[model samples]
Target: MVELRRDPVVERWITIPRERAASIEGLFPGKQEVSRGACPFCPTAMHEREIYSIKDDQGRWSVLVVPDLRPILEMEGTLERRAKGIYDGMSGVGAHEIVIETREHNQSWATMAADQLGLVLRAYRDRSSQLRGDKRFRAIFMAKNYGGMASRFSHPHSHVLALPIVPRTLVEEVQGSEDYFQYKERCVWCDVKEQELAKSERTVALTDRFLVHTPYASRYPFELNVMPFRHVADFASSTDEEIADLGGCLRTTFEIVKNRLHDPSYSMIIHSVPLRNASEHSYHWHIEIRPQLTSLAGFEWGTGFFTNPIPPEVAAQHLRG
Candidate 1:
């Protein structure tokens, strides 16, 4: 049976249609293609002309930074601003770098050791801190698109972009979170976590410091977000201990996804306060992990809405098992 939903953000009524799931009893259970032929991300292949790689004291290829061959915004372009009638355009000025996690072709986050993931997380923190020093960089965001939908490469890596303007999604979240905080005199997200935990519904996996859950009204099947348990405003300011705890959470999240979801393609992002707007009280740092289980149809973009077939309550139950 179809169900009606009330969205807090859109402040409107929505419908969730019912559908049957495909049976995967003997589906394509393929293993990860690790250490295959011609993996440039391998440590031995770091000498590629375009790669910026560094070695650790122990002599491992610990870090890598590369220019995206096809970047959304170009770095060498002039900042020419123009307007055509009601439309406006500006110079495409931004920096996009690919941070390769490891030299091993197959060592993804879930398969990596806790210490290794911690190092990758630290590298992200360090890179973000370094980019914030430049005044030209107004906003910085990092994203990992798994597989083709999430990325164009099979290597385990993420993209970091320093943009001239805040992203549209981030802008909406900042405004919404801030306004809700002011009116409620508390963080609405924090309130949400407390209620979710108390009710114990729509929660898939959890740790001492972080949790993974399907929101009350999900737009996609098996879509989830993993957020910190404590309150923090900036990702760069996280304590060393907090980073370790977060490493554990990251490991578990990927493990559960890989084992249960059958290695589905997903995109993960670390959302934090923008550099110029660092001290905003309304914004709280969080990480969102969304799996690409379904394609977006015309109805979604045209109406700016979606109808998730699997309810959050059911999705959580599936993941928990």
Candidate 2:
């Protein structure tokens, strides 16, 4: 049997292909281990392009933020908007960097110490806050791709992008939240958090400062949303104590997913208010972790619809270790 679920906040529809639920394990394409020569992120191969870092007691860097080895945008240019006969283009002028989460070559979020993870979060906030000074940038996006096709290397690192223009998907989300606020005079995310916390059906784990849960209309199996109770629009504003709590919350979420799903590849994205719109109250910041258990076929790409083999409630139950 198949069922359609609609996300109340974004109004996005998800199809639950329950008939394939029994064969959910078959959908996960095992991540192939790649044999690589030298890891550039290691201390020996590291360069001096350090943007930000946190050091240990011995003066060694624990978390390092450096420019991306293969950056999509260059920071050495002025914002130049160009137009052709019918299309518009702009100079690829922005900042792209990599946040090395740890000094250990094989450390992962599931096994990393919570305090170490907190340092990683601090690096993210520090770099993002510094990049926000550039008025030319409209959005600062931070994301992590673990294993599978989503990542090129096996090392645990995340990307930071300072984009000149806001991505369309984020723009839509902000607009949707704003629309909901205009209608109900409340933040959509806050309402969702309240409802999920009250129900506890889809809630996997909750910390004092953060809530980790499965979305009612989850886009993928084992997908989880991590939200802070504080209605802050900017991730950069997260305090030290909040970051410490969130580190534990994230570690628990990823460890559960890793142990239950056999360590499937995943993508995690931080969706915060745009750089200029840091004070927007309508949009609440959150992080989305989507494990790549299934591939997207023609139906998904053509119709903008996602099919989940397992229900979010069941997934939450399995994940609530």
- Encode model 2's per-residue lDDT on 1-321: one tens digit a residue: 333343444534343443445355545656344537998788877568888889999998898889986576767778776556544556767888999898788989999999899888988889889999998898888899998567878778999988887776888989999999999999999999999999999999899999999999998898899999999888988998999999998988889988999999999999989977733879999999989888888899998798889999999999875
The candidate maximizing TM-score is 2
Model 2 clash pairs are none
Clashes of 2: 0
TM-scores for all candidates: the values are 0.82, 0.88
Candidate 1 residue-wise lDDT, 46-83, digit = tens: 44544455568887677677777556655665555445
lDDT of 2 at 58: 100
Worst 10 residues of 2 by lDDT: 11-20
lDDT of each: 0.73, 0.84
Best by lDDT: 2
lDDT of 2: 0.84
**TM-score attained by model 1:** 0.82
RMSD of each: 10.0, 9.3
